[model samples]
Target: MMFRQLFDHASCTYTYLIADPVINAAILVDPVLEQVDRDLKLLDELGLTLQFCLETHIHADHVTGTGKLRDIAGCLGIVPQGAQASCADRYIQDLELLELGKVIIQALATPGHTDNHMAYMVNGNLILTGDALLIRGCGRTDFQGGDAGTLYDTITQRLFTLPDTTLVYPGHDYRGFTASTIGEEKQWNLRIVGRDRDSFVQFMSHLDLPDPKKMMEAIPANEECGRVSVVV
Candidate 1:
């Protein structure tokens, strides 16, 4: 397997490119529109064909590159079923397995940060936790129908249950840190470490974060797979 973690400094977004060595069939998760050229360059340099672009949810911070990449790479776009993104070629269900060459990526429904968020389980060892779980802190649950209790349950019951050694690759990280493990997060994640559901809910309820700068544009653009203007 070949793996690369690409970052968009502007939005603090992490895009993952994973490929199977046998055929160079690859899939990209959480690609940003501005980074399409860079991602395409990487694919070109590696001689890999993009088979799919997977979106965890309809992001509010930055526009996703799903449609552009699909048009350029001739790949399919997939999002969680709950995202209500008709622009996607298809929507994945929980526990559904998507195959890229010899590699299999399984989608896990772990909603909280958003009503339809999903974390991808890849090859049994790595988890791409979109925004449900971050490096040392979890995603803010102040909007998009976010619920703190659900996020708490997601962390403790769904994500924490994985093997302690499972690698965690988050969707976004403001800090420069790269990756963490299930055990590391469980023991040290400030938001979920020592708090119960109620406390966690209370903690998240007061975040008071300002809305994303690009929300007004990004939300509508992203729903159509990042087209600045959707004709249809």
Candidate 2:
């Protein structure tokens, strides 16, 4: 197993590459549009073939590189089954496993940040948590189709139930923190620390975060898999 973490400084997003070196099969999770070239270069240099592109959710801060990477690698673009991303080649449902060489990627429904949000588990050892659970905080439930109550359940019932040592790789991290264990998040994440659904909702509603600067542009582009105004 081989893993690489790529960070996008502008949006504080993280993209991950998990590969099975023995079979030369690989998958990219939550790849950033602006960083596709860098990612491709690295993949080329490593002599690995991209088998799939996995999206944790549709992002509002930055467009995803699913479509671009698909073109580059002729790989499948995987997104949540019910998600509305236009470029998704494969619609993933709960517990759906994608077999790639020696690695198995399983999708876990974890809606909170969005109704169709999902988390991917790799070989039951690592979880790629989209916006559902961050390092010290959880995703804000103030956006479209976002519900605090749902987020609460998703975290406690679904994610927290995983093993204590399960590695957690989140989609975005404004702070320098890169990764953490499920146990650490369960113990320290402020959003879910001893707070009930109503209280959590109330707290999140008042956070007063500035609207994502690229929301207007990024959402549309992401829906189409990072294509600009013109069709490729």
Candidate 3:
């Protein structure tokens, strides 16, 4: 198994490249439109074929590269079941496994940041926590059908129950931190460590966060698999 974490500085988004090197097959998770060339170039350099481009949810921060990559690389575009993206080639349901040779990626429904979000657990050792759980802080639950209570439940129950050594790779991080362990987060994550469900809900309600700058453009575009304008 081969894994690489790529970053798009503009949106503070983390795009993951996970591959089964024995078969030279790869999957790109949460790709950004502006960084397609970079991702493709790396794939080329690594001697790998892009098999799938997967999205955790419809993002509000930056446009996705799935549409373009599908057009260029001819890879399948996969999204969580019930997501609004009609352009996806496949819809992955909770607990469904996508296997690449010996490596396995399992989708877990963890919808709070967005109503259709999923967190992927790779080979049962690491999890790609897309917008549902960040390093020290979690995603904001103010829009796009977000529910703070659900988020709290997701973090404390679904995620925290994983092995203490499981690695956490978040979708985005404003701070310089890269990754954390489940045990570390449970002990130190300021957002969830000490707060109960009600306190967490009340606190998230008062964050007063401004909308992502690209929300208007990104949401509609993402629903169409990141096409700036739909053909129909």
Candidate 4:
């Protein structure tokens, strides 16, 4: 298995490239549209054929490259089940496996930041923790269909149970904290560690985060696979 983590400075988002050398097949996750040219160039240089373009959730921060990549690479677009993204070829469910060459991508439903959010585990070692978990914190639960209690349960019961050595690659980070282990987050994450459900909810409710600057534009564009047909 081969993987590369790409970062978009503007939105502090991380995009991923996972590939299998044997069959030369690859999949891209959470690609940013602005950086699609560079990503596509890299894929071309690597002699890999893109098999799938996967989205973890409908983003509220930046436009996605799923549609562009699908069109360019002629690959299938995969998204979380119930997320209404235009042109998505597959709607993944919890425990669904996507096989591309030697790489096996397993989908895990992790609804906290958003009701349709998902985390992808690659080869059982690397976990792509979309907006569900981050290095020192977790995603905000103040968005549409977001609930703090549900986030706590998802992290403690579902994600924290993974092996300590499992590498975590989050969807976004602004403080230069690129990645962390599941064990590290389970033990040290300020939001979800060592707190009861009620305390967690209270803490989350008190956090006065400003609404995302791109929310009014990004959400609707993201839902339409990066097109601006309707306003968010």
Best by lDDT: 3
| lDDT (Cα, 0-100) at 71 in candidate 1 | 89
TM-score of each: 0.97, 0.96, 0.98, 0.96
Compared to the true structure, candidate 2 yields what TM-score?
A: 0.96
Cα error of candidate 3 at position 64, Å: 0.2
lDDT string, candidate 3, 1-232, tens digits: 9999999998999999999999999999999999999999999999999999999999999999999999999999999999988889999999999999988999999988888899999999999999999999899989999999999999999999999999999999998999999999999999998899999999999999999988998999999998886332
Task: Indicate which candidate wins on TM-score.
Answer: 3
What digit string (tens of lDDT, one per residue) describes model 2 on residues 118-222?
Answer: 999998999999999999988887885888889999999999999999999999898789999999998898888989889987888898888898888888887
Name the lDDT value of residue 64 in candidate 1. 91
- Assess candidate 1 and give its TM-score to the true structure: 0.97
lDDT of each: 0.91, 0.88, 0.94, 0.90
Give per-residue lDDT, candidate 3, residue 135.
Answer: 96
Query: What lDDT tens digits, residue by residue, belong to model 4 across residues 1-232?
Result: 8899999988999999999988988899999988889899999999989988899999998888887888888988888998978657889999999998778899999998999999999999989999999888989999868899999999999999999999999999989988899999988998887799999999999999998888998888888888664332
Better of 1 and 2 by lDDT: 1
